[model samples]
Target: MPHHDGEQNGRGLSFAKRIYLPRTIGLSVGSVCVAVALYPLPWMHWIWAMLVMHAWVWPHLAYQRARRSSNPYKAELQNMLGDSFAGGIWVALMGFSALPSVAILAMMAMQNIAANGLRLLWQGLLANLLGAVLGFVLFTPQIQLASTPEEIYACLPLLVIYPAFIGWMGYKVALKLSEHKHVLSRLSRTDSLTGLINHGTWKDLLQVEFTRSQTLNRACCVALIDIDHFKTINDRYGHIVGDSVLKALSQALRDNIRASDLAGRYGGDELCVILPNTDLDLAVGILERLRQIVENQVDALLPELRISLSIGVAPYEQHIVDAASWLNEADKALYGAKSTGRNRVVSAPCTRADFQGLALGV
Candidate 1:
């Protein structure tokens, strides 16, 4: 789909050129054998003129026609029909020599399929048939029954080389498709601004970590982090500089987090981390370092502006019912940090009673 851009149908015209050129060469080469096996053309100049145009010139013509047309894809389809028509005409002129005629028709059908699959193949087949009728009218119907050794020898190159060429083309296209799929998969999970896992992907991982901790009976902490006075930063320095701050913070997260830890852009200026096999004290220590990292940083682009973070640490407890509750506890701790003073880490109390004292103690 990426290849198909700029006025939809125009998208695959280059693709059409790829289809056109090789088939043209193969058919042109095959024609020598067909001509020898059948009648020597009385219209020698005419035949050679058509052959040269098809072999040497048609690919460029087809590309230009498609590129210049309002509907390039549709124009290219017409070109494919032209190919089938020419193939049929050649078959008739060769008086239907069995091997050569069948070879030409089969190659036409394959070219049709490569351009637009079975439906287009059927259309090209009809075009070939119509051209055969025209050729019969113009040149008279005749069928050759035998091929000489020389004629057969001439056909050998096309038979051997053409199919191998098509197969190699197919292999390369498949590799490109695989690479595109990998890029799409990465983009779907990543935040464009921070280059961190997006909120939805991070939330999905949070649920998984929560379940893993419950099942394995391991300690884990979830931290919710928010940039302090982010709106003020945006207002004073504008969004471009604010974006730089987010990028810098993302770089810090990338640098500080261990392989086992997962950090993500939760939403806007908020970030979240899932630290498995880590308890409240360790989580607090990690968040404190991160808070320091954010606070001490000055924008490389706007050196006068500085940034800080309010972070909340909540360890998994036996009483926690679900992932949402665990995240809510961390959010409450984050709120505590923000409300008390920015640029600090607050750990949520295990129970409701200890909250006022312990949370504020941060």
Candidate 2:
């Protein structure tokens, strides 16, 4: 495949490095096979020297060429195609001896397919066929399908080692992909600023907790929290300090809550929590403690600034229709807290008369 020079350079270098060891081992072992097959032939001494150079020297040359190229991946691909071409030439030089020739060509095909899938495999095959035709024309070698014991023995190492190398490479790629997938998944579900679960994910979890409470007849509470006078803080101290306030509040929530509690950033300067297996009184106690912790925070950078939370808690009720109703109750309680006094916690009322009294800020 074609690659742009700038983007592919580092990737190309990695590709070349990955290929280097396998190329060295495969060629070194393959040379033995070719040498054995050529034993009975009356080829010139230069042919023997060329075989030695191809086995011992060519892998290093290919690596150096790819490393120097601007597009290393493309360069490595060309080097691999060259490997196929050289294998074809060796097969022809060995007079088309069946076992060793088939071994070399099959391993080359396997390498190409593993590297870049079908496209590289087909390209390598074409290059190999062309090299075979050229070699046949140059040397006019006699075709010999039968393979001797010496040729088979020489082919053994290549067959055993190269496949294990390919398998290991595949495993490394898979492991790296899985790690990246987890990181991406976490990033998607978390708030970048507060490092808490984001708004949508928290809402999804609220529904899940609500369903569990309904099915298991368990106690749970939902809390909606907002920073008191957050807009004033942002205007007075700027967004940077405001962000610090939010982070500090989140830290307070994280530190004070049980491990089972789920906290999230609901929106700008607003947060939420799900307290599973907790009644209204316990939820109030937990959030009130969180509020005191945030209110007591002392920042060396912004000493004059103080932070407080307005929180509303709604306990799960059998009469609550769905997760949305429960969240709405918590939201109403939060509104009451902010409306009456900005730095207090308000619990949702059970009766309609109490709800009306809360709505009127009585």
Best-fitting candidate, scored by TM-score: 2
Compute each candidate's TM-score over C-alphas.
Answer: 0.85, 0.91
Reference-based lDDT, each prediction:
0.81, 0.90
Candidate 1 local lDDT, 207-274, one digit each (tens):
99989988887999999989999999899889988898898899898888888899899988999899
Candidate 2: 10-residue stretch with minimal lDDT? 350-359
Scored by lDDT, model 2 comes in at 0.90
Q: Which runs of model 1 end up more than 4 angstroms from their true locations?
A: 1-6, 9-12, 32-45, 146-153, 277-282, 300-304, 317-319, 348-353, 358-362
Task: List, residue by residue over 1-362, the lDDT tens digit for candidate 2.
Answer: 44455557877798899899889988888788899999899999999999999999999999999999877888899999999998889889999998998889998998899888999999999988988999999999988889999888888887888788878888898999899999999999999999999999999999999999999989999999999999999999899888988888888889999999999999999999999999999999999999998888888977888888899999999999999999999988887787666799999864445656865867
